[model samples]
Target: MKKITPANLVPLLTAALPEKDMAHILNALVQFLRDGGVKRASQRFDLLLDAFKQNPELAREFGTRFHRWLGSIHIYPALVGLGIFSRSGFAREMGIRIYERFMPSFKDLNNLRDVFLYLFQRQNDEKWLHTVSLLQWLSLYDTLCRHSDPAAVQTASRHLEQARLHALEMLSIWVAAEELEPEFTRLEPKLMEVDSAFVALHQEISRLVAHYRSGQTEHYDTAHIAVMMEQCRAQVERLRRKGTGAGAGSSVKVAHLLERLSQTLDRLAVLLDIQTAPDEKECRRHCVRLLNSLTTAAVEQHSTELLRRRSINMLAKSISENTSGHGEHYITRNKREYFAMLASAAGGGVIIALMAGNKIRITGLGLGDFTTAFLAGLNYGIGFMFIHIVGCTVATKQPAMTAARIAEHVEHKAGARALESKLAKLLIDVARSQAVAVFGNVVVAVIVASVVAAAVAAHTGAPMLDAHTAAYQFKSLQPFTQPTLWYAAIAGVWLFCSGIISGFYDNRADYLNLRKRLTVQPLLKRLLPARPRAFLADYLHRHYGSLAGNFIFGMLLGMTGWFGHLLGLPLDIRHVAFSSANLGYAAVSDHSGFLYFLLNLAFVLMIGAVNLVVSFSLALTVALRSRGARIESLSKLIDTLWLQIKANPLSLLFPVQPPAAAGGNGNGGNGSSANGKAKE
Candidate 1:
């Protein structure tokens, strides 16, 4: 294998270039090297060096001619006040050098583009990639705009316009071809609609042109005309990716269409007066934006490229899909299911009480703060995992999951009125489910903690929580005077984050076939009996995301307070069920008055509300954004919710009984009742 060097390209460059221009090119090269500074110049020096070596006589002649244009090469004049040594200044200087010497005429630029096209065909060579990148062309254009004369700008614009024209011709030919009938069949209606709109726009433009010619330009609607043109442009773009497998004729036709569309859009942009903006920088910004939109429409229509462009949205959508099962479980459609949710939540509340009591012990251990946090994290994580494995529901975890389901419903529902009505009913279902879960968790957690406290005091001859500890617990649960509610919101944020993580991992598991891979692991075979190994793999396949989410949620709650202490900020998590349990322990230990106990309990409920609301709001926002669903204004949502409440007064608080079975021709029909029972 031979080592590649700059000198190896000398013969190629010499063969490609005109001998008469070699002296001017060499002189410009020396100036470019001097003015552009060593670092950037060094990167391109090898290419210039190789080309110079092609004709020694030309290089010698260029050396004598170099001084004549040395001053012209310094396009960036030093201005201390304006900061001469900047990116724009450097681009300007480089642009002028290339303009005056390397491409002194339009023919030279055309030759360069042709060479680029030829080299691009052989792009397997790594160097070609660098040469063909759009950044280089864009930089040259920017430099010409900054430092070159009107003639230079006209030359560049003419090239772009020519390219634009070619794309149009190609597209028109492709659309009119007989072989394109199948693809065009699907697109014909949309094309007709867009074309009609364009025809109308043309008529309007004709009138505007006449009005301008008659010296009555003030009557013209430029903004409206711009908007119509924009709509037409968008319609054209939507068709760009409709078909595949282009023959030579079709390829040429499609290429023409693309060029024509570009030219049309550019003409409209110029008419919009983007080039004549009051500020040059603002004009450039608009120009860039217009160019970018055109370029994106030209190239990004392929189905495969859409994935690369919208990767984040797709990832989020995948996560939301994973949470659908959990979300559906939160909406109880009958009395039986409603009670089941309550029972599940109550069971989860009992586990929470146990975890809270254990956490107090872990914190009381004379361990350092982080060590204690770590232990607490493990305790909470394992406790939550047990709750999940046992099929119990945590009241707070439902919001993040359910939000995605609601967003999905919003997307699939047909009309605005139908969607509104369905969305209203969904809110009723959500509200009832949330009300029952909160009731279950807070009531059961407090009762369980009170019983446990009483039992411990009776046996140990000491209160479950000592006086100082009880006071601290009471203080932490206080919402208004203390920062507890803020901590509750922090917990809500963590809940949102944990949901995202769960969805992310679930998507990863599906995408990467994690369970399939796990089943084949040698460690599983070595560590377990056959049946147990099979069970473990199957269980992990189904439950891995749920377990991981709960464990991480627990860890976040456990570490937050300790993290806060370290930062000297009042950062902590106030989970509703845990706070209620703590309140019960405090009340029992401190022997608080009824009023004070009631106030603390109220605060606990308020904290839970904040947790649920914050988490649900964030999750819904993400879910809707991922699905490209527009969220309604708050007032409209509230109004719809109120209408739903008025329409079905009892549905949001209690399950509605199924309607009576129809008596058609006296035939016995129990279908509705059976369906209702099935739902339960």
Candidate 2:
């Protein structure tokens, strides 16, 4: 038989191989490239490049087919590995198909880097290069997915997706290896030495791998793993530059070692939670795309990568932590929890009623504008804190935290219709929880305000508010007459902000090790006994976010009126509980008729609706955006919501059954039935 060489084999495969066996033939070609040694492989790769140079159509078919094969398998695994799965059958099958396709070829090729190098040298065209680079990336990914650590899978998937995007933008250039060689020659050989450097790097990486295999990963330095990998990568970079133009055949062993080193580094990076430079990954991706081209297809894949960059991972994780009921009991999961939520709201209403009556009386004392805001904020903040300490729920404050939880679910479950149904179930739980809380708040607020107003009247021989004050308070609650609804929405926005503040502080508590820091505080230890100081430290760590969120929310509400006065805008908050209490006071001060009293009561309910709806919508929007989730099919979601409502309308008003068990499939809506609460 004639000795196989690139010049004849390239033509023979194109002219003779059946189209049905393309993937098999490609696998064979990869094997042949691996076995042929560097000199022969380089010669064959160059001959194939010439063939592509001579026949553009043939080049396009090769590029297109190669691109199809590489991309065909990886989409599902990539998405699944990145935690971007819909968790549907489709996603699972995609991952399985990718695994099935790649696993069979794994043992046949010992060094994928050499195969990539062979392809990279002939990479003068974008289409061909894009295909080959994707194949190279898939090989690395396939190896990593069988591991135990989640970090490796996440990092690799993210890197691959980013690389694809970078390739599209940066690989469009006409890069000629012939032109690059002169530039390559100028770089120092000592720095570019592949043989010795790769061996050293390989041995170092193998040691780390051996440690992990032996369950001695604890001895590894996690922080410097990425740095070490980059240094090893530099060796592969030098050989990649030399290609066949200088002495490619001599570096086959280096390529083989480099592959092993790269794989080991990938596992170690995940084990240590060490991050790689995204910029470097992008550069590598562009290089691979160019290498795959080898003067073939020029088609550029559009950048479909989501803007949900890994930079937001920290922020998202914080929000997710707060939303998941992590020892805080915030999500409403069962029937017992639901009743507890209502009871808490009722308690909050009593506190809110007193706060409202006090704020009106204090503001009427003719204190300076700034002083009024400061005093009012103090009253509201302390009162809100009191309610929280007593385990009471504030109706509007639930959305911000719950939105994060819901968004997390959406991330794991992706299809539009599926997401819509999931949201509907969550919405049912949310709606019912809010309904009960609002019911509790409004009823108690009205009752408490009435009692407080009468008590003030008996003591001071005057109602809590004058006629002017009474009229203004009533108008504030009336949705149709003034900008009350808009102001309510503004208050809703503030509620959403408070949720973010709570989540931020919660995350900060963990990140800064607040309890540990507090425990060691010199003043705390010096002034207090060990046991007392430890107790105080633990308390602060657990309740700091709640204290902060409530205080800030109070300040926001109080300052809004003052800011509106300063700007001559009619801006003011209309919290449902507070507004309902105000309605009771206004009714008594004005001695309004029965009909007028009923109308005011109706207005208070409307105000509560505005407050809850606006706040929840804003919070959910932010939560979804933070996770890079955009549900484009609002109609479908609406339809699903309607179907759910139709199926169980009572669920929107009241949970028909007990909430699921704690940590069950509960909505995590209003949180647990625990005695403590986080409130706005």
Candidate 3:
């Protein structure tokens, strides 16, 4: 007959039983063995164990299956050893009952001890490695039981001492291994010292308990206990620093050991139930300082690594996308349109400036006056035109880019068409709003400038400049001076041409393909090197239109001079003849030409300052409003992305489902998880 041993019974019973039933069987066996029924247990154990002994194949199969079950939770090494003995005759006859009684209770403790020993032993065997992982889990239950029962402190303290001794012995074995060099060798002596200190502490506690049990009063030295804890904390900090400089393998081992040691110390402290002392507080403060230093270093290291990885990953993704067929096409088209618009706007402004300069030079003006007037006119005209062009472009194109990105995100989903529809609507709304704001602002600025000119004409008793110029004939330039009405007609035509160009450029650059195809400033150019020069380049590019607008404003001021002169009003020749001169004359006759010049000077300075401040303030209000809207939109988009991630994390790597569908699933999934079944 086969022997009734712990090893044979364990596999046989656990093979066919569920976890709860297996636990129950082990518990019963432990109780029976503890009751001293070794002989009686032998007969029953042999009958159950024969199935495993009869066929080596069956035994192997059962072992494999049982190991898988044990892997699900922690099991003791002694239990496993006992199970092996159940199949041997001598073991069953001599030690079967004793093994059965103690193995179950000691299972958790033995498993934990084995895991520590395995790390020291440096076993590379797969089976051993798997078994060690299972054992670590079992140790938690062992620690938990001891922590919960105050009355069992004495017993728990004894068990911890034994565990520490086992750990120290294992450390010694590792130190002897040549493969485990300077690091393990250094740690071994320290671990031994710690083990001795802990044992002494345990013994003192035991002595105190024994004295109490013997009806003698005993006082425990809480201060001494606190000092020991402080020492342990200091050791932990030293080990942490050493571990940081150690080789990777040694570092990992040291970190694991330190973690376990910390847990053990915490358990011991709880068992001691030490009261607070002034020195204890000081020790705690020191510990906090040490921990904070280590924690900060680790956090900074982790953050840097994370950022580096993200940057590398983004670059790689961008490179790959640029290489792809569709990606190349999209980029090419986008660049082409972007540059085309920028070139057209800049070229047109240069043409207008050149044209106006030629006309002024032909009028027989001095070089100084011509140069100043040309520069002022060029700045005003170009600045005005550029603002409308760039503002409209940004408003239209930014939304389109955003929409395309969103559409790509949802392209593979079931409701992709619906998503596309919604995105289209959003783009249209953004474009329309932008067009209205740009056009409306331009119209208002023109009207305000015209109204101010009209008011000046009425006050100065000047005929409308347009009327007087029509009647005059300059002998030197009779060919050019057809009529003031003709000049007004020409100005109207130029204004219309400028508006058409601005709108066309703004609309054309809004497409993704067109934006990339224009070689204005590539994303890489913006990204590659940190150059102060590049910032200057971007600034110049963004505000180049403003200079054009300023030139146009100056031209309009010059035109007002002709209107003043044609009305038989005083001319501010010093100030180049503009309606600003009218402000100098409150009394009709006292409005000298020199006073008109001063008036123009003061008005230009005052209006420029006031308009600049008001315009900047308005821009800030617009920017803040836009930021708040963008933040709210981004919040919604982020929530949608998170829902998609949760529904199917793989979707992030490859398109599995649309964001909309995932959002629906997320709401449904959350409801079900919280309330026990998804609604609808």
Candidate 4:
């Protein structure tokens, strides 16, 4: 038989608990051991459970100790206030953190939470606390209740009555707040009467709790209250469905509030169930679920996960959804669409080449680092802005936007097979579109830079780049010898940031009703005719986010080198399209041999690979996480991709033409193409 041992989490069961405070308890914990080492949470639980099964004497002592601690502290707050009804935002929590940093909140034993926290104040407490299953917790709870002192059990039950009342109060407050929120009001203009149901439930539950507390033995009619709860939940569900629709009114705060409302409703249901249960068995089941929930709340309270749980996913969904509409346009579907992408990319290449040349002229001005950076930023920013105005594609900008589009597809809750098939096809199209776009940008950028370099040389009677500068450019391309990949990764991160910035601005426009405001402006009404005013407002409304994104992205890229110089750090950006243009200038000016230039071109492509991999990975992660979807079977998706690649290479590269004209299977996707744009 296994030897009996106390659970690592068998809190307040030792000599330390009766005599010591939290600080002293913490000091004593270091001396606690199992197998001459710290036991894992699961192992410790199994050990304690074994002791309960085999050693009744030790079990009784543990149960008594547990009840003693519980009876001493108010257990209601842990049930009512934990992990439910966070109507307040993160700023309030941040203020609390700041206040706690200077002056802590755990000084007084406010409730059972304080005692629980004080008892298990070790760093690894939450690790074991969270990982333990409901059954384990239930088994322990059942045993403790059975073996605990009758007086202590009676005392704990009284505290539980206060917890029930508080839970009802929280439910009522949340329902009231939801009714007042503009976001929910917009979803249900008629006001779905949830607050009334919650109020009724609150009153009914309060009466039932009182009846139990007053030692009434009559059967309480809670059936009406349960029905009210169902109706309220249905109304909440309807609002949630409306919220998820592809509309303009949705925001992160709304999503968070909706999530919180749903959680509070469920939590209140559990509390209600514990009281109105038809039998002891039913009551125990409800009690077990409540215990598990409080465990989760306790674990999260001690970890950074509480903040993460509050808002990160909601913010991600907002950002991803905002970018998805624009991201769709940045893909090519057919030969016509591919050529259109190429054309747009070529236009971007021309502008980038001119921008690079202007940078050379700007560098020669002998300005300070800050001035150079500022002027260069304007040069790049204005050039990128022009590219956007002209509907041109900068290949490096594709990853950030395209990744968001891919995430939109992944956001579905369809069957895994269907999702995998849909995603695989979309991925192939995105890859094909990206490939041609990059080809157009790199090849055309190199050509334009070469022509401009030769023109400068012919006019000035010298190469545009001096021999010394050309040499430095050459060295910068060698990945093995220099940090070219690192710089490319920095560029990728900036690209992702630009996508997020674009999404954020778009969300702001929607939230602020910027388009509507612009149309109704007092100045515009007097200065311009309605037709022109409407057109101007409409155009800016649709395009403002992208334009802002491009300008900021350009500024980021342009100012990086100057920042590196000023900070004495090795920081810079290396975009694939821009770097290709630089390589072209170096080749033409330095009069380098073909083989060495070709080698450098290969290295530039490697830099492009790093850029795509990093940016796409980051964007994809954010996109997937935002939607709460997991691509569970990677091997299956990889297999599907392989099959597609093997079946029709052309389908993966070019759009599949109609079967009648192409004399082939109808497997290739001939979907409608979105006219591609990106620096655009």
What lDDT tens digits, residue by residue, belong to model 4 across residues 188-254?
7756454555456666666766777677877678787778788779877776555543345356567
Q: What does candidate 3's lDDT look like per residue over 274-369, in tens digits?
A: 211235344334333322222232222213233233223322222111111111111111222323333332333333333333333333344555
Q: Which sections of candidate 1 miss by over 4 Å?
A: 1-309, 414-416, 529-531, 632-636, 657-680
Error of 2 at 589 (Å): 1.9
lDDT of 3 at 43: 44
> Model 1 compared with the native: what TM-score?
0.57
TM-score of 2: 0.57
lDDT of 1 by residue, 1-680 (tens): 54435475454344433544433443343344443343444445544544445545534433333322222222111111011111122234345434544444332211322222222222122222223234433443344344434454555444433333333333223222312333333433444443444554565555554564464425445666667667656655544433211110112233234334444545445434542355555655565554444333322221222322233344456577666545766776566677877888888889988988999888888899999999999998889888878877788887888787788887667347566767876778787888888888889999999889999999999998899999999989877689888999999999888787776666555544466667678998788777777777767766667788888988998899899999999898999989999988889888889999899989998999999999999999888877678645557777887886876688888877324412221212321221211110
Tens digit per residue, CA lDDT, model 2, 1-680: 57664356567658634565444556555555544454455545545555555555555555545444443333322211222212133334345535644552332112222233223222222323333336444333222233324453445445544433232222111111112322233332454444443344444444544564464424454334345456645744554433212112112222223333333333333322322223545544543433333222111111112112322333454454464343224445466777777778888888889899889878888999999998998898888777776777787777776676677677667765578887777767766766777888889998889888888889999987888899888777767768888888888888878877776666566545578889899888889998988899888777677778888898999899999999998888888888889988888778889899888888878777777777678777776776566666779878999987887676777667434533464545543443355343
TM-score: which candidate is best? Answer: 4
Off by over 4 Å in 3: 1-377, 381-415, 468-680
Full-model lDDT, candidate 1: 0.61
Q: What local lDDT does model 1 show for residue 9?
A: 47
